[model samples]
Target: MRRHRSSREIAAAVFFAGLACATLGGMGQRCLPVAVVGHLCVDLAPRLREAAVLEPGRLFDVGPLGVSLGGCVANTGSRLLELGVDAHLAATVGDDDLAEVVRAAALRSFGERVTLDVEPGAGTSYSVVVEPPGQDRTFWHHSGANDAFTGGTLPPGDVVHVGYPSLLPGLLAKDGTPLLDLLRRASARGSTTSLDLAVVDEKSAAGQRDWADLFARVLPLVDVLSPSLDDLLSALRIDPGTTPRLDLADELAGRLLGWGAAVAVVSAGAEGLVVRTAGRERLERAGSALAPRAEAWAGRRFRRPVIAPRRIVSTNGAGDAATAGLLAAVAAGADPETAALVAVTVAATVIAGDRVTPTLLEDLVTPAPTTPSAPGDPAAGAAPSAPLLLPANQPRGRFYRGGAAIGAFRGTGAAEEFTPEDWVGSVTCVRGEPGIGETSLPDGVRLRDAVAADPEGWLGAAHVAAFGADTKLLVKLLDAGQRLPVHAHPHDDFAQTHCGTAHGKAEAWYILSPGEVWLGLARDLDAETLGRLVTEQDIDTLLGAMHRIPVAAGDRVYVPPGVLHAIGQGILLAEVQEPEDLSILLEWRDFELDGATDGHLDLGFPLALSAVEHSARSREQVEALLTRADDPGPGLPVAAEEYFRLDRHDVRGSAELEAGFAILVVTEGPLEIGGVPAPAGSTLLVAAAAGGLTVRGNGELLACRPPVAR
Candidate 1:
C-alpha cells in the first residue's frame, strides 16, 4: 500500500523534481538557472551574551564575532546554490578591504557564478550587526558602492531577481527608472523577473521618493514582486497601526496586483508569506519560467504560515532567502501554494543557522513509508520514529474571547476572537464535541491515528502496557482575553459515577503572562448557598468566595479536580491537563456564551453543581497550589503526577535529557533539543525512539509528558 503524503511533501517533491527537468534549460550541471542582482555587503556580526547590555559609553562582554556576506546577492544567491540551483550573482562592490571580504565570501560559495563589478576608489558596503540574545538584530548599514550601481546588464538566466532597490540608490533615483529598465530588459528576454525591497530609512532620500508611482511604472515588467510587509507599508505610505497583519497583507497584495505585477508576495515576519497572483493573461506574460503553469498560477490567493525553525540564530537574511526559494520554485514551474511552502521552508532553515540541504528538505516535507503490521495488530505503522512539529491547533467558535495572543505567540497571523486556546499534541476532543480539539499532524494524519498505529513507538512499551493507547496528557496555549467564568471540574470518581467519563479534568497552568487567578474558596459556604449561587447566578458573591492570587511568567499553578477556579483576563498560559474536558460552570455572566445551555457539560447544572469544592481554604492552603518560576524540578505540584508531568529546564551551556515520549516547548531563546533547532515560541514532539536528547545553547524549555506508567 502507498504511504499517505501531505500536500507539503508533494509540493516539495514537485518543486525539486521540476528543478531536475531539462526542459527549463540548465547552467553547467545545475538546472533552474537563477540570477540574483542588487545589493552586496560585508556583515560583521557580534554575538552578545544574556548579560550584555547596549548602553552608550559602556562596554559589555560579547561572544565570538562572525564576518559573513550580507545583502541580497550574498544571502539569496548563496541560498539558491545551497538548494542546488545555478544562481549567478550580479552585484557591485568597491576596490577596498571590505570588497575583498565580499569577494572571498561570494567566490567561496558561488565560484564562477559570481560576477562582481569593482568600482575604483569607491568603498564596499558593510553592516555592523548588533544581535543580542533572544532579540531581533539591529543593523548599522553603509550603502557605499551600492549607490554607484546603475542598472547593469542582465545575467543570462531563466529568472532574474533584482533585490534591495531601497538600498541601491542608483535604482531608486530618477523615480526607479533604472529598475524599470532592468526589469523591462529581463522581461523582453523572456526571463522571469523578480524584485525584492529592503527596509528604508524614513529620512533617507530613497524613502522620500514617490514609491507608489515608482512601482506603478516598474511592476508591469516584473513577474514577481516580494517585499517585507514593513517595507511595502513604508513604500506605499500605509499606516497599518491596528489592522490585522493578514488583512494588511491582502490590501498590500491588492495594490501590487493593481499596479500590474504578475504576482505579489508580502513577507510578513512570523505570519509567513502572503501571495496573490494576477489573472491568466497577465501571468501568461510573466516569463518563460512560469509560462508552463500560468493558468494554475493565476488569481490565486493564500497565506503560508512561517514554518518553525529548528532554532532561530538571526533573521538577518531570512527575507532574501525566502525570495530565493520563491524564485527557484517559479523557475521550476511550481504552483503558487507549493512555491509559497518552499519559500517559507527555505527561510526557516536559514533562521535555524542552517541551509536547506536536499536530504533535509526531503525529511521535512516527506512522510516516511512504513510497512504495515499483521492484521489486528495495534502497533502497525510507526517505524523510523522522529520528532513531529505540531502546528497551532486553535479551534474556532469557542465560548471564550481571545486567540490573538496565541496567534502572536505561534506567529500564525491574526486569529479570531473565540480561538483563545491552542491545543498542542492533543488526542482528546472537547467534551461532547468529537473531533473538535484533536490535533492533526502536518501530513493530515490525526495524532490519535498515529498513536494508535504504533502505540509502542509513540507512547513507549511501558506506557502502552500501563495505559493502553491513551496519551492521558492534553497540552494547551490558553489566552484569557477576558476573565473566565468561575467553574469546577469533577474528580475521576465523580465523573465515572455521574458523567460516565473515563477521567476527570485535572489541569495545571504554566504562566506565560502576568495576571491574577481565583483558586479554591476563601471562606466555607454551604451546598445550598453554592447551589443558590449557580441557580441565581450571583457573580459577585461567588467570585468573592474564592481566593484571588497573583501570578507571573514561569509560575506554575495546579488545579486539582473539583477545585473551583477561574483564569483571570489579560493572561496567557501554557496548560497541561488530563485527556478529558469536563467543566461545571458556576458563573457565566457578561460572556457571549449561553452558559445556561452549554456551560454545564450537558449533565445539567443541578447535577454538575455536586462536583464543586465548597470547603473553605486558608491563604496558606491556596498558596500551596502555586509554584514560583524558580522552583526546583517538575514545575507542577506533586499531586499532578497522577495525571501529567511538566519539567522546566533553564539550559545554559548544555543539558542531557533522558529519552521519553514528551512534548518540548521552547519558552525562550534559540537552542537545539535532540539535534533539532528549537527557537523560542516553538513546540516539538519528541518520540521515545528519539532517545537520549542533548540540549545545546541557552534557552528555557518546558517538557510536558504523560505520567509514569503504573
Candidate 2:
C-alpha cells in the first residue's frame, strides 16, 4: 500500500523541490529567475468623479495623478517579485526622457535583472488611464517603443513569459514568426515557455491580422498559456452569446490544449481562474520545475472562485497578479487546485491594496509547523540564547478605542488612535493574516521567525518534541476604552474540523484595572433564538442574557472556548490564550466595524453561531472560573493550567527564578532581573537556555509560559 502524506510533509516536499530548482545550474543562486519579456510602459491615472464632465476643451478638478509602471513587465513581474520570485525584465524602452521613469520604477524591485533595450529615435510607450468612480478603467495608449520590439535578448532564466502579444506590432509582422522563434529558443533551452495576451482591438493594425493562425503556430512551443476570457474570444474571432462562463472557459481551454499547449489558464474577471491541463506525457514535458509533479498535474480541470477582499480598491492588475501566483506555485510544484487557490489569493491581495509574501503562499499549502523536531536541526544556532527585550507591538485599525493605558504601561509615548492591543512576545499572527499580529524583537527580527528557526533553543527540547515550533501561546495587553463587542471563540475541535486551523481560542485575563465584565449565559437558550437575537442587533437582550460580574485589579478570569463574553470599558488587562485570533462577534452596532460583513469569521452566521455555548452557566460555576492574583500556587483557575501557566512572583528583597521559555511582564516593579533594570511596565522574553536567573528588587513580576509540553 502507498504511504499517506500529511499536509506538512507535502509542503516540505514541495518546498525542497522548489529549493532544488532555485539553484539551477548549481551556481549557488537562492531564487529561481522568471523572465518577463514584452510590453513595458508608463501609466498615469487621474481619478475622476462618476459624473465628471469631459467635453473637448473643458477642464475638471480631479484627484492626484498616480504615476506608475504598466504592462506585463511591471504588473506581472513586480507581482512575481512580491511572491518571492526573482522576476527579470526583458523588454524595451525608447531613448527618451520617459525611459528614465520606467527604469527608476522597474529597478526598484527587479534591480539588475531589468534589461531594457533602448530604441533610439523612438518615443517610450505610455498610457493615460482614465478611472472614474465605480467604473471600469479606459486607456489611451501609444505603442511607441513597443512597436519596435523584436523579442530579442530574452533574459536567461528558467521560465520565459511573453506577454501582451496583441500589442507588439513587430512580433505580428510576419505571421508571428518572430514570436514563434522566441518560444522555440526558450523551449530549446529547457526553459518553460509561457504566453499571455492583451485584449485585441479590432481597429488596430496588429489586431486586424490572423490571430488564430498566430496562436496556432506559437502555442505548440508554449508550456503555459494564460489569457483573459474576452481576449481569447477576440483573438479566436469567436462569440458565444449568453453561454455560462465556466462552460465557455472549458471550451476555450480545451481548444488551447488541443492546439498542443500543456496547460491553459483562463481568467474570467471576478469569476476567478479556470485551469485545464494535458495528460501525463505532455505534462512531463512542461518543464523541469513542474515535471516532478506531472502525475498530479496530468489531466486536471477545475475552477477556483475568488476570495473577496474586505474592500475592493481598483481591479487594475488583478489578472496579472493571478498569473503571477499561478506561475510561482507551478514552479514550486503545487497541484492544480493549490495553484488555482494561490492564484485567487494573490489576486485578492492586489484588490485589497496589500502585497503578497511567500509566508502567505506557504500557509495555503500547509498548517503551522507542529510535527516533531528532526535530528540535528539547522536553525538551532539562530535561536535566542539570552533574554531579549520586546518593543511595543500594538497593531492599529481596531474597531474599539483606547490605547492610552497600554501606551503608559509599555513606556511608549502617545499611542495612535485605534491601537488597542499590545501583543507581547507573540509568535502568532491575526487570523487570515500571516505577518500582521506577530511580535518583532528589538533588532528587527520577527518573533515567529526566530521561534521557527530554533524551536529547541527557544521552546525547549520537550516542547519541540511535542509541538514542533508552535509557541502554542499568545500574550496581549488589551485596553478596552469602550465596552467590547460581544464575542465568542470556537474550541479546538470546531476550529480544526470547520475552520482549517490548529488551535481554538481559550483565554485568561489578569486584570490590571477594575471593571464589570459580561461572562457566560444567564439562562438556557436554543441556537435558533440566539441567532435571532444576534441578527436583530438586540444589544440590550444580548448583554442582559450574560452574567455580569465585577472584576478588580489582581483578579484572574478564565474564559473557555465557545463562551460568550465582553470586556467593559476602562478595563486594562494582560491576557494569555491559544495562539489564534478567531473571534465570532455577536454585536458590532455603534462601533467602527461593520458587523454584518465581518462578524462571522467568514463562516456565515448560521454556521458560526453553532460554535457558541448556548447552555446557561450558574453564578457558582461562573465564580469558580475566577481567582485572585494573590491566590496560592497558580495565578488562574486549575482549568487554565492545561492551556497556559501564569505565576506572580513577589520580591521583597531578592529571588531566584527557574528559567524557561516565557514572557515576563513587570507588573509593579522598580526592580532588576539578572542586572537588567526592569522597571514598572517593561516586558522581556526569557529563553530556556538562560537557565535559573537571580531577580533582585522590591516589586511584582508575572511570568507567562505555554502549557507544559507532554
CA lDDT, every model vs. true structure? 0.78, 0.78
Best by TM-score: 1
TM-score of 1: 0.52
TM-score on alpha carbons, each prediction: 0.52, 0.48
- Weakest lDDT window of 10 consecutive positions for candidate 1: 363-372
Residue 199 CA displacement from its true place in model 2, Å:
0.3
In the predicted model 2, the residue pairs found to clash are none
Residue-wise lDDT of candidate 1 within 148-183, one digit each (tens)?
876564455678888889899888777777777677
- Expressed as tens digits, the lDDT of each residue in 60-176 for candidate 2 is 888888999989888998888776676667788999999999888876656655778889989999998887888777888998999988787666556778889899988777888
Model 1 spans with C-alpha error above 4 angstroms: 1-384
Among these predictions, the greatest lDDT belongs to 2
TM-score for candidate 2 = 0.48
